[model samples]
Target: MRTIEVFADVLCPFTHVGLRTLVDRRGRYGLTEPRLRIRAWPLELINDGPLDPHHIAAEIAALRGSVRPDLFAGFSVDAFPGTSMAAFALTAAADRTGDPALVEDVGMALRNAVFEEGLDIGRPEIVEPIAVRFGLEPLDVEATSAAVRADWEEGRTRGVIGSPHFFAEDGSGWFCPSLAISRDDVGNFVVAWKHGTEAFIDRVFG
Candidate 1:
C-alpha cells in the first residue's frame, strides 16, 4: 500500500471536511492502495495559543452556508477542544502502532468528536475510550508528544503551510485541496471549489 501523508489538526473544521471527503470518496475511485497517513500539524502550537472557538464557529457557519451543509450538522463551538496537542499525540501514537486502519479510525474519531459529536476531546475520558475501542495500548505522554513534534518538524521541512496538507508518494503536495478559501471585501470567508481539485485527487489516488 502507498501512504499519502496528510498534515492536519483535529480541531480544524477545514481539515475535517478535507479528510472526510477523502474517506467518503476513496472507495468510489475504486482504489485502496493509497492509504491516508494523517500527521500532526497542531494549529495551537503553530499559532502560539489556543484556537478561539468563536473564530472556528464563524468558519463553520460559512462552510455550512456555502459548501458543506450536509456536514458539521452537530458542531458546537462551545464543545471545541481547548488544545489539540494531546489529541495529536494520540494520533501520532496510533500511527506508531503500524496499523493503517487504527490510524485512520483514531484520526477520524478525534475530528468527529469535535465536529459531529460536539465532545470536548481535550478530556482524557472522552479521548481514552476511542483509543480503547480500537485496542490501542496506552502510550507514554512524553513519547507521544515527541512523536507529534517530530511530525511538526517534518512538515515544516516539507512545506506544510496549513492543516489538511496532502503529499503523495512522490513528494508532490497540495494545501487544502477540498476547497479554496479567501476573504471578501467585508472580511467574510468565501469558500469555493478549486479548479481541477477532483483531477488532483484522482491523480493521487487512482
Candidate 2:
C-alpha cells in the first residue's frame, strides 16, 4: 500500500475542497487503498491565535462554490474559532490509534463542523462527543499536544508552508493541490481545475 501524508488546518476551506476532490475522485486517479495520514498544520498556531479565515474573502469565494456547489451559492463563512489547537489535538489522538480510516473519518467530521456548520472546533465540547462516537478514549492532552507540534515541525522540515499540502509515498509534496485559483477577465474569483495532481497520484501508487 502507498502511504501519503496530508497536512492541513481544520478551518481551511481549501484543505476541505482539496481533500474532498481527492477522495471523490480516487478511482479516476487510480489510487487503490492508499494509506493517507492526516497531519495538522494548525493555522492559528503557526500564525498565532486570533486570526479568522473569513478575512481572506477572495480565496474563500473562489473555491468554496466550485468545490461544493450543492452546499451554497457563494462564500460567506460563519463564525469560527481563533485557534485550531484543540481540534489538532483531537486529530493527533485519532492518528495515534494507527487507523487511517478512523483518522480520515474523525478528521473530516471535524473539518465539516468548522467549515460547513460554522462551529468552533477548537472546543473540547465539540470534539469529545465525536471522539466517543468513534469509540476512542479521552484524549491525552499533553501527549497529543506534543504530537501536534511534532506534526507541524515535521511539515516545516519538509517545507510545508500552507494547508492542503500533500506528501506522497515516493517523497513528493504539493500545496493547495487539485485546483488552481485565478482571476477571470472580469477580475472575479475563479477556480480552474488544473494542477500536477494526476502525476502526484501516479508517482505514489503507480
Candidate 3:
C-alpha cells in the first residue's frame, strides 16, 4: 500500500492548513485506501510547554480566512488549549480501531474543533462531542494516551523538530510544508501554500 506518514500538532495552525491541503487534493492525487497515515507530533512535549497562542493569532487568522472564511471568522483570539494530548490520543485511538478513514476524520475534526470552532479539544468532553459528530464512539483513553506517547518518541528518533511534518513513502520528509503553511519571524505564521498542492501530490502519489 502506498502511504504518506504525517506528524502534526492539533494546536499548530500550520498542521490545520497542511492537513486541509492533503484532503483537498486527495482525490486529484488518486489517494485511495490507506494512502496517508497521520500521527500526533506533540509540540508541547518537544518544547516542554504550551506554545504561545497569542503570538500566532494573526498568522492563523490570515490562512484560515483564505482556506475557509466562515470557519476563520469563528476562530477565537482568547481561547487556547494547554495541551493537545487528548486530541492526539483520539487520532491514535481511531487508528487502532483499524479504520483509516476514521483516523483521518478524527484528525480533521480535532483540528477544526480547536483552531476553527474555538473548542477546547484538549479535554475529553470536547473531544467526545466532536467524535459523536463524526459518528464515532469514545476511544479508550488509556490506550490512546499510550499511543500518543509512542508516536512522540518515534518522531523524536526520526529527527522531527516541529509540527505539520510529512514523510513520503520513500522516507523523504518536510516540516510545515510550503503552500501548506506560513509563519512569522518566530515561526508564528507567515503564509502557507497557494499553489504547491499539485507539486506535493506529484511527490507523494505521482
Candidate 4:
C-alpha cells in the first residue's frame, strides 16, 4: 500500500477538476478504499482585500471556459462566491472531525454552492447551511474556522505553492490532475508487480 498525500485549496476550480477526476478514477487508481490521504492546504484567492464580485464572476467564467466548459457552460458565475473563506473553513472542519471524508464532502458542497447554486461562501451564515447538510455539529464549524486560519498561516510557512499538489511515498510529486498517470498505466504497473519480474523492474525503474 502506498500513501499519496494530496494538497489542495478549495477555492481553486482546478482543484475541483482534479478532485472530480480522481473520484472518477478511484477504483482504477487503486483508491477503492481509504488509502489516499488528502491534506487540505488553504490558499487565498484575493490577496489585498475583498475581491470584487464582478471580477470573481469573470474569473470563474474564464476558468469554466478553459477547463470544464461543458459543466460550467450557461452557468452563472455571479451565483458562486469566491473560494478563500470556504477553503479555510474546510481545513477547520477536517481538523475537528478526524474524518477526511467530511472534508471532501464539504469541499464538493462548497464548490457546488458557488458554481452550481451561486451562493456567497465568504459569509459564515451562508456556509452554515452547507455544514448542516453534511450533518456536522455547530462546534465543528467553529473549530473548522479556527483550524483553517491556523492552517493557512502554517501552509504559507511550509512553502505551499498552490493547490492540487500531490506527493507520493517514493518522493515523486505532481502539481495537477493532468500530471497523474492514466488508468492503463496504473493497471500495467499492478500487473507487472503481480506477474512479471522483468516487467516490474522495467515499469518501476525504466
Write down the lDDT of every candidate, Cα atoms only.
0.83, 0.73, 0.72, 0.54
lDDT tens string, model 4, 36-90?
4456565553264544556545544545544455444333555545445654564
Judged by TM-score, which candidate is best? 1
Which 10 residues in a row give candidate 2 its minimum summed lDDT? 70-79
TM-score-sorted candidate list, best first: 1, 2, 3, 4
- For candidate 2, what is the lDDT? 0.73
Q: Point out the worst 10-residue segment of candidate 4 by lDDT.
A: 188-197
Q: 92-179, model 1: which lDDT tens digit per residue?
A: 7789888777788899988888888888988777888887887775466888778878889999999999998999988889999879
Of 1 and 4, the candidate ahead on TM-score is 1
Pairing residues by index, what is the TM-score of model 3? 0.80
Clashes per candidate, residues 3 or more apart or on different chains: 0, 0, 9, 4
Error of 4 at 95 (Å): 3.1
lDDT of 4 at 49: 50
**Model 4 segments more than 4 A misplaced:** 1-4, 27-31, 34-42, 52-63, 73-75, 138-146, 169-171, 177-206
Task: Go through the candidates in order and give the C-alpha RMSD of each one to the true structure.
Answer: 1.4, 3.1, 3.3, 9.5
State every prediction's TM-score relative to the real structure.
Answer: 0.94, 0.82, 0.80, 0.63
Clashing pairs in 4: 79-118, 80-118, 92-144, 93-144
Residues 45-70, candidate 3, lDDT per residue (tens digit)? 77888878775577666776566554
| Model 3, residue pairs in steric clash | 179-193, 180-193, 181-191, 181-192, 182-190, 182-191, 183-189, 183-190, 184-189
After superposition, the stretches of candidate 2 with alpha carbons farther than 4 Å from their true spots are 27-32, 56-58, 71-78, 138-140, 182-190, 201-205
lDDT of 2 at 64: 58
